[model samples]
Target: MTSLVKVLNENTIYNSEKLSNFIKYLEEKYIIKDEVIFFNQLVNFSQNNSIPLHGWFKYREGYSHTLVREMITRFTIDTKKEFIVDPFCGAGTTLVEAAVNNLDSMGVDVNPMSVAVTNAKTNSYSKADIEEVKLLIEEIPSIDLDQTEIIDYEDIQQYFSEDNFRALLAIKEFVNNISKPSVKELFFSGFLSIIEDSSDRKRDGNGLKKSLSKVTSVIDFYCDKMKLLMADISESSFCNIGKGYFGSATQLDKYVHEFSEEINKKPGLIVFSPPYANSFDYFESYKMELRMGDFIPRLGVKGLSDLRRLAIRSFVSAAKDPIEVDEIIDLMAIEIEEAIPLKETYTGKKDSRTRKVPQMIRGYFHDMGKVLEKCGKVLESGHKCCIVVDQSSYLGKIVPTDLFLAYLGEQVGFNVKEIIICRKAKTSGQQLQKYPYLAESLRESIVVLEKK
Candidate 1:
């Protein structure tokens, strides 16, 4: 049986058997350890709902605070460096956890909503800010906005009932007039959190879809969300602990350098989950929220397209951009490219998206390699970098994302300590019909690396 390493090095076509053998080979070579019980609910977002500040927003993409706490506990043992860094700070879970532990941290993301969420959850909330939020809630009923100014984003309008849509606009107007920056952020955060719930459509898979969910009144929902935010703020000891920047992880060094200069400390541990190689575009998933919050409007008219280009090239839709990177994993890219069938291969129906997988895979790794290189530069010596990522399957071809990232980490001055297989993941139902063999092979893993 051809090994994955040999196939990758030879730049040969990877068949299902070769791919299967390669996974087994990697498992043995890396000393794979299954620790599913250890990570049970820690890797999920459902556990976050009852946890003070974490529960303020329902971010389905984020990992739990317990998971971050576990990483800090394991890595922060004897390390002299005292700061945490989350390059892909989705929902600010890592930053919040760092702050909860009284450690200074910084986070960066391409999405403005992500930065906004991180800033809201991690920023210091003063007593006056809390008072201002209370006043806004009291004035919620009397506040009504003139509809002439608000740009009619039809996409967002379709997701809500007429009354609910009007309520959303009213709150957006109300949030804009708030004087205090911190208070404004807090209210804005609360408003964004309720967007999915208020809309008739829910964020499912790659984008929003019509759902059975209903909100009696958008205003009531926002009020309830604010109350939750207020309670978390009143009880939490968050004091400007983490800085969230609206930027990319490939520029990890720049973000870290700015923060390091102020605090005189490099990141003790780097914990992040980049977008998976799966063709899931986060911009599409949060389109309503992004438009409603005016995060995209800052990018001009072609806001969504521009933002997608800025994000890591993990999705197929982003494959249209020119592929450019410092290091190209030529062999693996070749194999992935070959495995994706040509347009002629489809017998019945053809997915045009399938043709772009090869380029997306190449771009994803090249983009990730740059991020790893920057991670290697910014992370403290001998400190660990923990990555949460899921492997993907296209047709019958399995993309071992965890292993590839580990390989990339090694190339960029890091030692792979171990790969903890969190759980065996199944491929999409559609893919499973065509590729049953991939079901048992794919997994979600934590790639732990120490900067050498």
Candidate 2:
């Protein structure tokens, strides 16, 4: 994929009328002159690495807990006024942050692994809980990786020495046997958190790639991680003990319907970063934990692809025929389709990426449209939906996701309230080829919309 992006680079931005018209439409329609605010660091997860309970599991796609907190404070919403909601609550960063601030929260995700991880982070735990987990760990009997029927990933064996792999398996088996659900989840989370060390995979911008492997002490690392998690739980100023559900964000009403009487009393303040139009499969990124921890029963490569298809259509794997639409989604699809031919006129032949990216863009907006419409059904009329999204450059054309989604929000009865420019990303060497024509830096946009 990296090589393909390089192939698409003509070093000269080809002029396309459709691209200009789309940008012009965005500027005129949604981006008001003084409303584009800048917040460089807050749009990312760097700060969350140091945060207490929120830092336990490293979900590559999550934004900062600080971003959620600041957005909440900016709204000046006390739980007394409204409960926080994060529909695409990857790893519960927003809900966990809300818990720290003594606010009520409700979060749900399409990914079960994500939901389980979120539940682990958001649930209350005591010193007794930590000690209980420690006792279970202490009770684990030594196992021979050579004899166990449980298998590690086919190629993952190369990343870990046999001894290290054996130790990890023993811990996984031990944690799996624990009878207590919440404590088991907490301990399992700590176990998953340290899985990356046993593999060469390191997170790189929404995806994981083979990187330098680290020398690790498997059992000791899990023990240390459990201690950190227990410490965070001990120190929490949990006010509402937010609940997390293992379900799709698009089914917000169904998830909340069980507690509708209580939920409807407070309007919802939602803050989440949905998957981007770029095709970075989360299942692929966390394969180490997914496979080794047995999150799914034998979810190999094919199973991972199947799961990807079920995710919001941000990645190519999730692409389906674009549904007929007359609004911003259709316009973006038209712009993408019209812009690609221009690349061919100047660059001899268009790269295949140019051909496929438009469909992905179309499908992404289509899925996002569903998500927004569902949010409208459940959110209170005056509350805001805060979203963090990055502009993606696909096939030598930049996709203005933030701007387009804001317009789409308006279509779903949302007021385009504020556009926060978190950061203007520095051009990648590959992206520089499309320069003079494409904007130099991609943007991380925080689009805030109020339900009308």
Candidate 3:
């Protein structure tokens, strides 16, 4: 067997030749399949279902389930371990797969809403729970559309007719009355999934935000979204699972430590698609959901600024150290420097926010490192971890996220085994002129690491 130490060094960018050789060796030894075939299978499965975990969250900028599954398969093969950990688990794709495979798994994210969605999707529950929630929703008094005036809310009002909004609010009110955390979370998952579609924001055919309208009503939008959410939840297997929690990954160690010996031995697997190195602000993109769910106060004139502060603080709190902040800032600075030349090459004016990419990148990695460190401590030795990440470009400079994270994983005591380059679909509205190098390729790489 190749030594863990050797594998760790092989993941570095400087060791590209050795890394390629090692990956080929693993493919032959472990019967690893081709990337193209693997991607095709996932796409087909998603098309058949029309509701991939990727599609369910409708995070236009998120990672695909095909990529997530590939990472899980690769890690399980290499370590021959069933348990997994995704410290930055979002929307519970990893947790749901883990549950389906009957692997004990653990997932964590700083976003409370993400935790709610993931938890709702992964927990085991009874058919009775769904029936009961359904009955409860039916019993709630019908919402009077004329009285509610849901369109008055600023964030998401224009997407739905008044009747749909009232129906959605009624469901929310009914779910609120139910004291069961598992039931409430399951319902909430459905509620959140519909937010974008019910809003005034123009959606691409796949239900992602294109542009937000000023006249949008947040309340009405949330109401309509809740109805769609309810329908989606009713269709999923998650209605039968256990409840997940709302907490930061940085606090996972403490939470896990409190579990009794018997529970601790259950061993957990985590699969997640964390924020990318590029400057996609998940907090802002998803702020409407939070606002509608009452997770955060309204985003008024001061809303964006207030939310930004909250986001930065939340991320920083989840990080392992003060220095991580600086490291992420440095990485973002590198991205900014690269993007500047691209600005001249591309016709449109660059978003001023592009300049702040460095700070966001810094904060993202810093928190991710801390979460990984915590995961290392909580996961049992010999367990496997699979992170699906992409290499990003800012300006024209490439951010070798897979290699950089592999290095960070080693520093936190995990052993980097392989980095698999898989070709996947490109992001929406991604102009080839804007990303000349990416025109012929949509490369999504998976970094497989094992807990020592």
Estimate every model's Cα lDDT from 0 to 1: 0.79, 0.71, 0.55
Instruction: Say which prediction, candidate 2 or candidate 3, comes out ahead on lDDT.
Output: 2
- In model 3, state the lDDT of residue 341: 52
TM-score: model 2 vs. ground truth = 0.86
lDDT (Cα, tens digit) per residue for candidate 1, span 1-452: 22334434443326445454555566566745677766875656448778988887777778768877888888773234568899999889899988888888999998889789889988887788788878888887666645624466765667778777788888988898998898899999999988888888988888778984488877778888888888888888675469899888989999999998887776788998788998888888788888899877632348788888789998887766667642334444555566555524755556677778878888898899999999999876888999988888776666788988887888899998998877766578877776555555577788999999
Alpha carbon lDDT at 308, candidate 2: 70
Regions more than 4 Å wrong, model 1: 1-13, 16-26, 41-46, 77-81, 145-155, 298-301, 321-329, 342-346
TM-score of model 3 (CA atoms)? 0.71
Cα error of candidate 2 at position 447, Å? 1.2
Q: Which pairs, if any, clash in model 1?
A: none
Model 3, C-alpha of 184: deviation from truth (Å): 3.4
Model 2 lDDT per residue over 269-382, tens place: 878899877766677677667667676655456756656766787765556564665455555566667777776887888567557766777778877888888778877788
lDDT of 2 at 63: 82
Candidate 1 to native Cα RMSD, angstroms = 3.9
